[model samples]
Target: MYKLGFIGMGNMASAIQEGFINSGYIKADEICGFDLSEIATEKAKARGVTPLSDGHEVIRNAEIIFMAVKPQVVEKVVAPLKEDLKGKALVSMVLGYDFAKYETMLDPSTRHLTFMPNTPIAVGEGMILLEDQQTLTDDEYDFIKKAFESAGSVEVLPSHLMGVGGALSGCAPAYIYMVIEALADGAVAQGLPRASAYKLASQTVLGSGKMQLASGLHPGILKDNVTSPAGSTIKGVKALEDGGLRAAFINAIEKSMGK
Candidate 1:
């Protein structure tokens, strides 16, 4: 029965709102959104939620506030709401931003939760990380957990690791999509239809990922188990090695974190 308001109607916010509605955790009317664009407002209304004209209006109406605005705008948006934020549970999906940062901007009386959920949450396979400030009560934490569980799996992490966890999860979706697309392209190069190649490549990657988790085996060991002497798997492994696929993935992570 909590009233939730998202200050940004961007993709991540929309994804989460879609999850809440689809999972029956909250009704459309229980959720409200504020976006500066008329198109964005109309888009939110189409989803059966109220579209607010100003960010402060959403704060005034909500018991829970989702700070889904971009990192660049977070400071400006939260600054004016400091006095109006009392008694609300503030959750943020903005990357490169942390709970301490949000705590400094909001009312000292409000409960704070820092979260970073991946794009998969839109499809119910999302990974979520939650970090709370000093003000969280037992009941507040429970409600936060329940609200996120409606979107996907939620895990509590040390506040110090919040940014790192978010960088590795929230921003890694594009990397995964790149790998998936590259794998399908390779299959197509071998004379498979583009559609069929994508189907097989995606499903294979998904099953392999499930196996890695279920079996708790190192990815190298899983690769070894699948590759036999004089087999096609061995040839594929050789190709990946020659192209420096592993090194490229490592470099991608380093580049993402500005290492």
Candidate 2:
């Protein structure tokens, strides 16, 4: 039996498989996945994942199953496997979907978990948010945490805060990418080559984030440290403030959470 099973072999599911394999946490053979798309299953097979014929087959052969399909079709995908999921831990990566829905759709004895992991997981530098409906045992919880941590940081939050946490961490990579692009564009406007600009801008953001995490200092303080009296950094900071950068980001998160 495979240790991990995926009901969908889309991008997110592929990312998780890559992360786990790259991290040496689990070998590719330990995973089995099934997708309606033949192309997707072929891709999974190329990555050493055992590709199954259907979701029911995956559920039967794997200990832990991840529902990586779209939220709207999740019920349809799992409904037929109600019997196979009994006493198994089923993890869902669908946004805005809750554990109660899965419990009602699947067998009552099925254990459920909701996970929110971003695309960065493919690179082993992602942020993962987790919420479980009190179904995992101590060992099960630790195993799941360690599995995800191989790909990036892991935070287990109250179910009530999953949406907020998902917005902050799950949506953050895109926001950061936008910031990187804007910074690169500004550099290009100043005569820097596009490729060099992207490298510089991305590295700067990456370093700044690492510094913040390592130092445990307030971001405001870190900004202040970089902004010298009448300096270029301060000038850029002023430009951002003038453009309502902070407010724009705050609004973006609120909108993402459907607030």
Alpha carbon lDDT of each predicted model: 0.82, 0.89
Q: Per-residue lDDT tens digits of candidate 2, residues 21-123?
A: 9899999999999998998989999999999988888988998999899878877777778888889988888887776656667777888888899888888
Q: What is the lDDT of residue 115 in candidate 1?
A: 83
Instruction: State which candidate has the highest lDDT.
Output: 2
The TM-score values for the models, in the order shown, are: 0.92, 0.96
**Model 2 regions lying over 4 Å from their true place:** none
**For candidate 2, which ten residues in a row score worst on lDDT?**
98-107
